[model samples]
Target: MLGGLWEWWRRRRLLVDASFAAPLLLLAVFYQGELDQGIYGFPGVGFLGYWALHAGLLLPLVWRRRWPRATFAIIALACFGQWLLHVPLMAGDVAVLYGLYTVTAYCSFRWSLAAVLVTLLGAVLEAAQLANLPREFRWAVMFLSAVCVGVWLLGLHMRTRRAYLRSLEERAERLERERGNELQVARAAERARIARELHDVVAHNVSVIVVQADGAAFTLDTDPDRARKALETISETGRTALAEMRRLVGVLRENAHESGDGYAPQPGVEQLAELVDQMHRSGLPVTLTVDGTPIEVSEGRQLTIFRVVQEALTNTLKHGGPRAAARVTVRYAPDAIEVRVSDDGRGAAAPDDGRGHGLVGMRERVAVYGGRVRAAPRPGGGFEVIARIPVREEART
Candidate 1:
């Protein structure tokens, strides 16, 4: 509530300043009226001059912040004229101090310094004007000079503080912009990764379904049992592909589940045996072997290994001939884990299409763990994919 009030006043400052100046003008007019009526021993100043002088002294204060230099100039001129014409003491003169403050805080110190000099000069002339006054009364000039310097210093302090606050606000804005940019980059990278996962899942599983469906169609009558088995493989492969899709899509969801059932966890190294068994049923005839003790790796690294093997064998299914067979070897080292997928198939005949992104995805995933992937045709025949994911020393078994 206080914050709202301060903001409201800030917007209407000109009206507030005018309101302050109105009271001062009224108070001075009352005193000037008494002085004009011979209520004191001082010489009577005319009503016209009194109104003219006091208005010039205080009314300009309304615009002191908006046009501080012009306001101070008008007030300083009237203040000097008040002394030259022997005007009686009025509260309107105090506006000069406020005008000087506005010039110091809103304008530069170099400009306010001249107002300080003029005020000092006025103090000396005021001392001279009250020459017959007592020593204690005359000492008021020193007090007035101190007040002038004190207000000037206060304005200077406010100016420095305001500048510092402005600089801090600008710095905060710059940091916010940088943070927004970083989030956009991270979001883009994540979307690209999800795209790669989708491609690998769909391409691999769809290829298995196509192979099984083609075999079932060819042997539907002559080999009824083999046809039934191929149809079963197709159904199971479709369900597996759907599960993989849900796992990937769950990453984008807020509730982490669909239809009141939790999504399946991601495929990892432990699931390799099941994956190989499914591939054998799909007519891909893949053999799996593991070497050395497995290390305790992060889920992301394990997913990297699984996806690399999946993409390599999927490519072999698409390009390897009917008689082809594949071997997947997982070698566990102290500092690294490796998956080498090689197929004894006619891999050299595979199209070198620049459109393929499976290898690209494999490289991107392994690169996250400071690892590398090598994919190329074997010396005599077939194709091989070796992805080595570095294991942190602490994760070594």
Candidate 2:
């Protein structure tokens, strides 16, 4: 609280300068008679002139901070005029040092240097007026000169300190902005990861349940056994989805390590056969074919490949007609892996609301590996999904 008020007071520069000049103005009025009398016989414009000179010296100080060079020039001219007329120095003459300090603090180094030379010259010339008091003149002038130089030095120090503080404040603000941006980026990345997981879990499993339920409804009166099988598939798919939902909730609620791999390892090449078999049970015909020697890759890259294939096949099962068939092909190369899923169905003619994010999610996953995905309706009355993910040497399992 005190610091805040102190800063507030500093910002009221004009008010502060006025307060500084108040005491000097009072001294110039009441204390001029206390100094030694002038040498000239002529009073030189009488009492009003003295008051005017005193006001001129002090009043300009109110603008010292805003107009340092001008303020100092006006005050210095009045002080020199008073000295040339042999008006013995008064108490308010201290404003001369204050003006020099302002010039040093706010003006360029050149102006500050000139101010110091002028002040030192005035001090020597004033001391010479008291040449009869030789013992005190030298010391008094030396002391005055030292005070003037010291005040100038103090002003320079103040300028340097203010500049340093400003630099620190600027740096702090920059870091705060950068930190906020980084947090936004991290949150966006996390949201994307959660989105991909939800798509994989909910879309594929719910579609299976939906397909099986439809099948059971159609076969209920015609074939009891087929209906029973369809109902069982629906039940199984629902339970699997429920289990996955629980796992996702647990991962969100606890630390990843605390969950103890509760995220559940995602299916990769080893599970493709099972995926094919599962599709068969769902009444979709899919053929899985692998080309080139299988290369071991990290779980993350494997998961990427798996999601691409999973999204493609799920899309196929949902869109492909009862008689449509899909072919799954996995090709491996020295530097990359490709998964191609194509279905001979209604192709782009399939009824879609255009709200699906399956293909977009697949593209995002593949792009993270500096890869690409092409999902389009094939020319020959079919739809195709092709994903290629890079396999860096360091990605070996």
TM-score of each: 0.53, 0.51
The residue-by-residue lDDT of candidate 1 on 197-296, one tens digit each, is 5545556777889999999999998999999999999998786666546445534323223244322345789988888888888789999999999877
- Relative to the true structure, how large is the alpha-carbon lDDT of every model? 0.79, 0.77
- Shift of residue 258 alpha carbon in model 1, Å: 32
Q: Considering every candidate listed, which one attains the maximal lDDT?
A: 1
Least lDDT summed over 10 consecutive residues: which range in candidate 1?
A: 253-262
TM-score of 2: 0.51
What is candidate 2's lDDT per residue for 44-78, written digit by digit as tens? 54667777888878889899889988888898899
What CA RMSD would you report for each candidate?
18.6, 19.6
lDDT of 1: 0.79
Candidate 2, position 133, lDDT: 85
Please identify model 1 stretches exceeding 4 Å from their true place.
1-10, 37-44, 132-141, 167-179, 206-224, 231-397
Off by more than 4 A, model 2:
1-12, 33-45, 132-137, 199-228, 231-397
